[model samples]
Target: MTASGLPMPGGTGGERELLEQWLDLHRATLAAKCEGLSDEQLRRTSAPPSGLTLLGLVRHLADVERHWFRRMWRDEDSAPLYCTETDRALGFVVTEADTGAEALAVWRREVDRARKAAAERALDEVAVHPRRTDWQTSLRWMYLHMIGEYARHNGHADLLRERIDGATGF
Candidate 1:
């Protein structure tokens, strides 16, 4: 288990298995960071000038998962779950009615879709880039990119959680 009481990724496994394990661990870490916080607390910004919050991160990550896995990788005709074309940063701006539970539900659904998409293809199989249509990348690259993204954001989550209530851990 991690310091946050979430299960850690296994030490030994195949490359794909290990990658998925690490990704799951990071996902759990993010969830653990938001544990025990009220809806209002989850929406609290990390600092005065920044809009970063646990709920915002959850919403953003759900969009990320949907973009990469369903839209880009699976070639599904999906739209953004939270943001609009005019306001691309809407995920980071929580309203009075936006609750942590709703955000988490969306995140979990996207994660399930991502796993299904990944399972349908080999890691070495190439997927078209969402923005750069001419460019293609392997599933392995996508997994690694997501892991790095989560790791970086999880660090931010750690600090944000600490600032919220003096709680800190992996």
Candidate 2:
């Protein structure tokens, strides 16, 4: 594993193992992006007219994890942590009360719950869609979706981190 705890997915691992490893790598990569930054830096936006911050990304990802793993996968009745009924993008809008430590802690907790829920079901097991009951999804697809989600956001995080302190290539 590297500084981000990004372990290279082994070549001979099973499908589930490989997917989980990849997902974990991306998760760790995001965490690593937020490393060594102060609260102010974490809350700084990358460009003008954009409210996207490292802390906001962390909070948003937490909601994503909870939505997929806990609410959808486990069929739990859960509400949004940072989002509101009218503003679904509230997680991306950081307030003065929001702190990097708190957002990261929440994200870690959501990751733990996601892992636990995923372990309880096989990759092929179908979970009902949270909004549309007529639609169903498999655990495998969820893992893939999350991996992609992390990958996309990690790219944004990379840019944010770079702009914050001129740090690159974590």
Candidate 3:
């Protein structure tokens, strides 16, 4: 584990295990970035020009998890947690009513659902994309896509964290 108590990514493992570990590591890294922060701090923007915030990232990730795992993978009728057609980036639009605790809780629930959705599925198992009817995606691709999504957002989270406070590192 690192100083934040998150499990370290495994050095050696099977493909599935490695993917899951790396995904979890990135997820935990996002959570770790919000540690020791107040609700106001979580909502604080990284800079004036950018509206990115730790809370917004948490909410956006929750929707991403739901979209990929439940909506697409399981073909469930789960609506987005925050986003809508009018405001596609609604999840990243934190309002005065939004709180860090609630956002984190929702994100955690989505993560749990995502794990359950993929648990028994083989990597090569294919599913139709919910939005793109002509596109078929495999479980392996979903895992890889999710890892990249988290990695990219975690980079944003890192910048947001450093801007919020002096906190930096892994």
Q: What lDDT would candidate 2 get against the real structure?
A: 0.90
Structural similarity to truth (TM-score) of each candidate: 0.94, 0.95, 0.96
> How far in Å is the alpha carbon of 118 misplaced in model 2?
0.3
Q: Which candidate number has the best lDDT?
A: 3
Superposed Cα deviation of residue 43, candidate 2 (Å): 0.5
How many clashes (backbone atoms < 3 Å, residues ≥3 apart in a chain or on different chains) does model 3 have?
Answer: 0
Query: Which regions of candidate 2 deviate over 4 angstroms?
Result: 3-5
lDDT of 3 by residue, 37-102 (tens): 999999999888889899999999999999999987788999889998457688999988999999
- List, residue by residue over 1-170, the lDDT tens digit for candidate 1: 76657878889989999999999999999999988899999999988789889999999899889988998778998889988756768877888799999999999999999999999989999988766889998999999999998999999999999999998886
Candidate 2 least-lDDT 10 residues: 1-10
The candidate with the higher lDDT, 1 or 3, is: 3
Q: Is candidate 1 or candidate 2 better by TM-score?
A: 2
* Total backbone clashes of candidate 1, pairs 3 or more residues apart or in separate chains: 0
Clashing residue pairs in all predictions, respectively, total 0, 0, 0
